[model samples]
Target chain A: MSATESVITTQKRSIWAGGMSPLKVTYGKLMMWFFLLSDAFTFSALLITYGLIRYSYPGYEGNPADFVFAPDKWWPIPEKVFEAVPFLHGVSAPLVFVGIMTFILIMSSVTMVLAVEAGHRMDRAAVEKWMLWTVLGGIAFLSCQAWEWSHFIHGTHEGPMVAEGTTFFGANLLQNQYGPPPFADLFFFITGFHGTHVLSGVILNIIIFYNVVVGLYDKRGHYEMVEKVGLYWHFVDLVWVFVFTFYYLI
Target chain B: MTMASEESKTIQVTPPDKAKIRKIWMTALFLGVVTAVEFVIAFTMGASAFRTSLFVGLTLVKAFYIVSEFMHLKYEMKVLIWSILIPTIFIVWLLLALLIEGEAIFMVKF
Candidate 1:
């Protein structure tokens, strides 16, 4: 080859190498991590706000252990108020359902990790399978959360005593049911924000799943998409860790 | 034509070993056991100071494993690790400061 031809060939080779190189990381995954980091701040703000509200309003009428919703007074005990379904009626399963939701999210995170691993191996089948599981897990968690929301919204209220936008757990802020006005407002705001995240995650996972099935990522010869979604999924799981702690355990 | 052949060669490589798969499963199982312990402690133990401390401690343990293993931060560069850790520390500090201030405001208002 002529000297000029060799130089051009080398340049072509370098460009080819760059284009063909398997991406160990992708811009999408990096951006997802950044998104999760910002989301962490949002949740931290909400939870800290909750703590402040709870701490300042100490010695309200009801016991934190056995709290009941009274229009005049009472802070709804996290345990008493959150007892929910799939554990059957008359059984004290407060926080149990939320606990299950936590587990589902975490397990799905595990599946996401597996998908990333599969991506590393270039194992298309494994990626598809695990991504499917992760998607299903996200859906299951959203369903449980939706049920929890409905239960909160339509809580037991009797005639004459019943008030608009008021539920059995506590008094509504926009309207009064149980304890103070801010209680319901904070509950809706915090949990609503988290639910919105779960919704977006579900949508994201579905997109990733579609990408896997259609072999978009396989053609690109990188599974960084899976890794990025894994990061996001894990972040969602981590936020729940704090939620389970401060909101439920503490 | 040459580039196409090179790409084909790379694509045809075999999968990783079963040992790696086994290791991944073991790590996942360990995470599961840790989660079960967390559940037990949260449910069975009374809401005492000690229980609270223990719960927080176990949660940190679980968080560490999830971040290091599942998120593959262990094999990553120190710069990456510090990048995540430093921000997280600042966030916690911010949360504490804000929480205290918020409580004071609430006390004044209520």
Candidate 2:
């Protein structure tokens, strides 16, 4: 081997400099991946905090089966607090509406995947079509969340009222009709944080949609942008899965 | 600028795979089914410690599936996967610390 070649091969190197990216991924993808990981930490902290606080509170006293919608205690059941549906008020359907919302978010994630697939095929029309549908799905989910929030604000007909020494009725940062104060606070905080993410994702999708219509990707001859957005959209969907379980189901 | 007028930015393009399309569909269906099962279990099952653990386990399954399939993490190299996942171990530490602290708070006051 040539002396220069031998020296080059044998040179000691710092680990980070030796290989910038062993995965051979683009900078954009790497950043997005790390970003999602950090985001997951914040969510993990919040959910774990919920668990911590939940176990500390003295829960309702009665047979669990008979109290599906009775949420007036130190540690009320989530289904009891969130059983109301918009316009179908008084007709109790435990977790039914939230289930629909979950499916909606899942459907949007599916469309986002389709859009990324279209982008891979260099089909501009298909990309635009699927992206638009994805945006619509985001809006639908936000609307559902808004309805849910309003329903929560209106207070349940069966609430024990805020004046009661044992149960605090109505919701604020300080108190809620549901069980302990932390229950409502965490619900509002976690779901509100998630709702903000959905809003931001929708806004991002709109920007992407506009770019698609303006032929930005057409000129560039690739739609890795769509794929990046797909990553983000799917992350939102994934987060919602956790939120639904920890906040509603559990 | 000395760039040629006829030249344009180039990128590698691969043809779409029909199998991938099928895979996406199956993933969505699987996630949907899992969610539906979670709902069923929630309603039918009594509130117990076992029920909570079951829901949490199912949730993790769904989360892993979405990350692998929809986020395409399955296609990534091992190094990248490790980088993203290993940091999450710290979260377990955080949970342990906080839960103990929270229990202490309960013991002290509420």
Candidate 3:
């Protein structure tokens, strides 16, 4: 043992020596993972901030069944505020629209994973088909968000009075008919941030889809790019699960 | 140039596995069912600590499926899994601290 140790000591070895993929993943994928970790922190900070602000507000102490929407209430019930559905005026459908939106996102995520799976097999035709579906799904989800946002911004038909002679018609940065100003602001910020992610994910998917159609990945002999983008897409879906829980459900 | 070629060589494109595809759809179905359950609870049940906790638990279940199955993190190396999961604990801690502090502020101000 001593002779071998002396021989090994004579030859220098550095732990910092490069040329090894320790995680058994490509450099691009590893970087994406780290970027996602940092992005996770950013989102966590936003959500935790929302939780803190929500906690600071005094919620309704009455029975949930007897609850009604009042302008003076500091913390408005989510179901009451988000009751209206598209094309169904004055309908008391709580969480239904958001549920549809969630379903769309999850379906898109499924299509995305299918695309990645198709990529794994180097099936160009299948990849194109699934990627197209995934892209369409993303566009559909974004369209749903736009409709929801417009609906939220325009607000209900009642246009309840917020103050003396000041009828609140809709929500904005300064004021809203629903709860507090922060509620509207956080809704816009968090959902807007998430919407931006979905938008970017769609654009990225388009680019990758274009590349796939153009036979770029085929020429390159690999489709790891799709897998990387799939990671980001899945992360977006993951974030929505929590947002649905926090903003809509809780 | 050699490194690029060597890397490509190590990356093999295998035929798609039917079992794996079935697993993906099954996970998706699980996510959809959990979400539907959340919707049902949102309507059927009223707001309370228990209801909130139930929703949160179901959300974690959905998150687990998305991360593990969709993201394929479950098949990754152990070190990679730990590296991602460990940092998330601090986020939970932040939530706890700020919630407590927020409640205190409300108690004092209101």
Candidate 4:
């Protein structure tokens, strides 16, 4: 071949020549990935803000064993504040409820993967089964959060006195029995944001499940739709891992 | 029959792989165990720099599994993986900058 002709042929064969996907995915899937990447940035920004606000406060400097929820401490110990579980009032069960919530999210994520796998095999019945389980898990996580939020709102009976004549009760945007205002504020913002994502994920999974039952994807000759939604569901679970680490574990 | 039914008839469906499903469940079990360990540390150990680092490290590990295995990012093309992961580098820089600023503010106030 002539030199110019060879160059032209190479140019036509380039991955970016617009005939094939360089990313090896459909246009819709690629868009979903980009959307998730942007969402990750948003979540990271919120988390970074939480870290900054948290660091700006004067945290407790005393012995960790001697830590207690007091007005003077600008950063109340997390375990001490988040010790309540459902139906077990006044019991100090540190990290148990959140642990369950984490497991639920992770389990749901696993089911989502299974659904995607089933979709790949064109197993409509299997996809429906796993998708149903995933939706239920999402709902379970949301219910757990609602209970946790209510418990936080209903502060402990022995809440510390914030002022000489004022005893701080539950938490709000303005005030909280917790260490500082930003503490409760960040908790609400971060977890509430994550919860919103989970809620939407549940809704999307339901729609996908309905479509699966109707044999829409089966008729369409591909279950790529389930795979796309699976990506979103897994991203939700991934974000929760970070949230659980920062908000609860740390 | 309708065109849709005719199209569905021509589509090839792979039989389900038992091993893949088992692997997915295994990953779920691993995540559960790691979370359980985190709880154990929370209750047993006091707040310290070391403990915080451990928690962050474990969290990253869990995130890796979710993104790679469950999200199927590992199976994607390298160009796609890099495109998604590279932007997160800036998030690390943002975190470091804001944390230093926050600590400085605390020092000034206290």
Kindly report, for each predicted structure in the order presented, the TM-score of its chain A compared with the true chain A. Answer: 0.79, 0.88, 0.92, 0.93
Judged by DockQ cut-offs, the docking class of candidate 2 is medium
Cα lDDT of model 3 by residue, A136-205, tens digit: 9999989999988998888888546676677777799988888788889999999999999999999999
RMSD, one per candidate, in order: 6.0, 3.7, 4.3, 2.5
Model 4, B6-109: lDDT tens digits are: 76677677888888988898888999988888988998887889999999999999898889889988999999999999989999999999999999988997
For candidate 4, the docking band is: medium
- Global lDDT of each model? 0.72, 0.84, 0.88, 0.88
lDDT of 1 by residue, A1-250 (tens): 5998889777735523665423243557556656766787788889887877766664344335544455444444566567757537556676778878887888888888888888888887888999899889988988898888776666543312434553344235564454456667777888888878778888988898898777777568877877887887877777777777777666
Global fold similarity of model 3 (TM-score):
0.91
State every prediction's TM-score relative to the real structure. 0.80, 0.88, 0.91, 0.93
Which DockQ-derived CAPRI band holds candidate 3? medium
Instruction: Give candidate 4's error at residue A10 in angstroms.
Output: 7.2
State the lDDT of candidate 4 residue by residue for A182-230, as single tens digits. 8889989999999999999999999999999878998877899999999
Global CA lDDT of candidate 2, please? 0.84
Best by DockQ: 4
C-alpha RMSD of candidate 4: 2.5
Candidate 1 — which residues are off by over 4 angstroms?
A1-27, A59-66, A70-74, A157-178, B1-10, B102-110
Q: Give lDDT tens digits, candidate 3, residues B52-109.
A: 9999899999989998989999999898899889999989899999999999988987
Model 3 misplacement above 4 A: A1-16, A163-165, B1-15
Share of reference contacts kept by candidate 3: 0.73
Over A1-250, each residue of candidate 2 has an lDDT whose tens digit, in order, gives 6999999989987566855665778789889998989899988888888978976766666786565323334577788777777788588788989999999999999999999998888777788999999999999999999989877766777765554355544677776666567777888889999999999999999999898887678677778888888898999999999999988987
